[model samples]
Target: MMGLLLSLLSGLIFGAGLAISGMADPARVQAFLDIFGAWDPTLAFVMGGALIPMAIAWKLRKGMKKPLAAGAFDLPGTRQIDKKLALGALFFGVGWGISGLCPGPALADLAIAPGPAAIFIGAMLGGMALHKITVE
Candidate 1:
């Protein structure tokens, strides 16, 4: 129950951050991506703001035996730069560049604009399902 509560709280914080940071708007994201055409650097500030807390969490995690909300630290074991990782990153970047909506912000937009958000989420899920069937 505690773990579930923590998860919910974490998600709410993340969603609220996305909404407040204007990341939930595809137009803002696309403008940030548009380097040669009316580029907006606001997202860079948001990314920098996020990195500060994440960097601190990573530094703290190095000394922790277990996460506060979990029995053990379930960190990724791999540090390899393999084909699969590279290809996955490429696909993710391409999708983000094309749609201007990564998964988190896209999910956050669902409450504001249901129709397009649903379509994007549906397509994303379909891609994930396809990847699962093909790869795993």
Candidate 2:
């Protein structure tokens, strides 16, 4: 129950940050990506803002035995740069560049911009399903 509450709270905070930072707007994100056009650099500040606390958390986690809400830290096991990882990242970047809606922002946009967000989310889920079906 406590873990679930913490998860919900964390998600709410993240979604709120996305919404407040104008990241929930596809146009804003697209503008940020549009170099040589009417480009916006506000997202860089958002990224930097998010990175500070995350970096602190990571640094703090190194000295901790367990998380406050969980029994143990479930960190990623691998640090390798392999083909599958690279290809997945490339696909994600392409999708984001084209749609201007990555998962977090897309999900945050659902309440405000339902139509396009739904379409993007549906397509994203379809891609995930396709990957599950095709990949090992």
Candidate 3:
């Protein structure tokens, strides 16, 4: 129950941050990606701002025995850059470039613009399902 509550709280905070930072807007995100055209660097500041807390968390994780709401810190155990990693990154980059929205922003946009967000979320879920069926 505690973990569930913590998860919800964390999600809410993340979603709120996305909304507040204007990350939830596809046009703004697309502008940020448009370096060759009408580029926007505002999102860069937002990304940089996020690194502060994450850097602190990474440092703190070095000394942690367990998470506050979980039995263990389920960190990624791999450091190798394999074919799978490269292919996945390529796909992610292509998708982000085309759609101007990734999973986090897409999910956050659900409340602001349900139509487009729903379409993107549905396609994302379908892709995940396809990956599970074929890969795992």
Candidate 4:
């Protein structure tokens, strides 16, 4: 129950941040992503804004015994830059560049345009399914 509440609050805050930053609009996100033609550095600042809190949380987590509930520092162990990592990043970048919608931003934008959101989400899920089947 507590975790569910926290999750909802977190999502609300995330959506609020996206809306406030104008990232919920695909055009704004696209403009921010467009570095070659008409570049916008708004996203850099937004990213930096998010990073500050994340850095603080990372430092705080290091000192804590465990999280508020369960799980003890469940961080990724692999630091190796392998083909899988590179390929995943490449695909993610291509998707973001073409659609101006990363996972978080895409979810946030769903409130405005359900059609594209539904299609994009379906494609995303399909990719996940394909990856799972192929990886196995």
- Candidate 4: which pairs clash? none
Cα lDDT over the full model 2: 0.90
lDDT of 2 by residue, 40-89 (tens): 99888888887999999999998999999999999779999999899999
Best by TM-score: 3
Residue 95, candidate 3: alpha-carbon lDDT:
84
Which residue pairs clash in candidate 2?
none
Residue-level lDDT for 108 in candidate 3: 91
**Relative to the true structure, how large is the alpha-carbon lDDT of every model?**
0.89, 0.90, 0.91, 0.83
When sorted by TM-score, best at the front, the candidate numbers are 3, 1, 2, 4
| TM-score per candidate, chains pooled | 0.94, 0.92, 0.95, 0.90
Off by over 4 Å in 3: none
Q: Measured by TM-score, how close is model 4 to the native structure?
A: 0.90
Which residue pairs in model 3 clash with each other?
none
Error of 3 at 124 (Å): 0.6
